[model samples]
Target: MPRVVFLLVPRVHLLDVAGPAQVFSTADDLGHPYTLTYVAEEPEVATVQGLVLRTETAWPSLAPDDLIVVPGWRGPTRPASAGTLRRLRDHHASGGTVAGVCAGADALGRAGLLDGRRCTTHHTVQDELARLHPRAEVVKDALYVEDDRIVTSAGVAGGIDAALHLVAARHGPRAAGEAARAMLVHMHRDGTAEQVSPLLRWRSHVDETVHRLQDLIETRFAERLPLRLLAEATGCSERTVTRLFSRATGLTPLAYQTALRLERAGHLLERGATAETAARAVGFEDARALRRLRARPGRTMHSKEASWTQAHP
Candidate 1:
């Protein structure tokens, strides 16, 4: 069993702590055997939401597989104690993974973990984090960033995405997908996907039918999904589905599916897959279609052969 130790700070955001905790806890319920522990400077810590939380003062023994998460807090950031900072540094030095959420990245910076590594935080604090840690590469407008073994995320709910990513890294995407479904998270965003990814861009509406249609298309993007099949799945007429999807997401059902396919193909290509393999894997009939998509203006491939590369690499 791997232990997930949460280092709670004063005035911590409730969701930042609860969201990721729920992910690991649910993974445990799903037979992943993750043990969660909460530790703070004192026995009791007050939250920014005015709720007080109890914690253990002593740090537990940790192994490389164990994770240490620092949940962000509210108000002006304060530096942690030298001893606490040392513990963070020592843990990663011993091959453990350390993560920072929102303003909690300050703690990682203070511990020298972010130096020479790529990281991110709440947009409001991006410049401040960069100024504080000049050696760190601060990525703006990203949901999260994982460089080497250190992970950092943007503000608030971004912690859930980052934690889900960690779950996927540890137990595979299937486990992470199950955990996300259990939490009612409709979509699981990849770390490489920016804050405004196509996967999440059109999800800000309240149309359940559109959402369902998108979910179906996203899950089976590689299959040939006819408009009639999509309409039937969502219990709407083909014309209604088209209008609703277009009105909500600014794209037709087929266009949305094509976007998903292209995005996945980009990732596959970035990982060194040949264009033919990527096209087949992402449901494209051949590399020619993928090449045409890439050749279109503003549709660059994400691999080294193209313009954009992996954020970590």
Candidate 2:
């Protein structure tokens, strides 16, 4: 079983700790073996939310596959104790993965782990993080960044996305998707804020009708789903469904379905599936439709896909 350890500090933000912790806990509930541990410099730590949390003062034995995460705290950055910094550096040197959320990146920087590493933090502190650690390449407008074995997130809800990304990387997209669904997290952004998963994109609104239609379309993207069936599912007229969906997601129902199919087809292609096989599996009539979509302007491969291609080619 992989162990996930969270190192808490004074005035730690509750959501920064809970969000990622919940993701891993949900994954564990879904049969992914994960042991979560919490540690702090003292036996008790106070949160910015005014809650006192109890934690272990002694560190646990960790392996290469285990993860250590530092949740951000409130106020200015404070340097960690020498012993704590040593533990973080030694764990990473032993090949364990380390993550810093929001202001937690400051901890990693003080330990010199961010030197030459690409990292991100809450947008409010991005400039300060860059100024403090000149050697670290601080990424802006990114939900999270992973370099070497170091993961840094923008903090708050962005920690959930980073945790989901880590889950997808460790397990698979299916597992991550399952966890997200269980948590009602229908939106999933990639590393950059501008890019997101097709299945999870355009879902930031609170329109119940549109959400109902999206749920239906996502589950049946590989099947023939006409506008009438979608409208009937939401008890709305075809025109209303079309109008609401377009307004909420900025894409027509058909366009949304097409994006899902195209994304699935891209994944299949990356896994060595032939064009015909992928197209048929993703509801394309044939390879021609898939080819057209792939060849269309502004339909270029995502950064993750491009990286896969470069490695495999």
Residue 93 CA displacement from its true place in model 1, Å: 0.6
Find the 10 residues in a row with the least total lDDT in model 2.
304-313
lDDT per residue as tens, model 1, 15-56: 989999999999999989999999988899999999999999
CA lDDT scores, all candidates in order: 0.86, 0.86
- TM-score of the candidate numbered 2? 0.64
lDDT for model 2 comes to: 0.86
- Compared with the true structure, what per-residue lDDT tens digits does model 2 show for residues 1-313? 9999999999999999999999999999998879999999889999999999999999999999999999999886374698999999999999999999989999999999999999999988999999999999998778899999899999999999999999999999888889998999865556765235666667888999999998998998888777789978988999999889878978777777777877778778755689999999988768887887677655634322332112111
Error of 1 at 233 (Å): 31
Query: Per-candidate RMSD vs. true structure?
Result: 8.5, 8.5
All candidates' TM-scores?
A: 0.67, 0.64
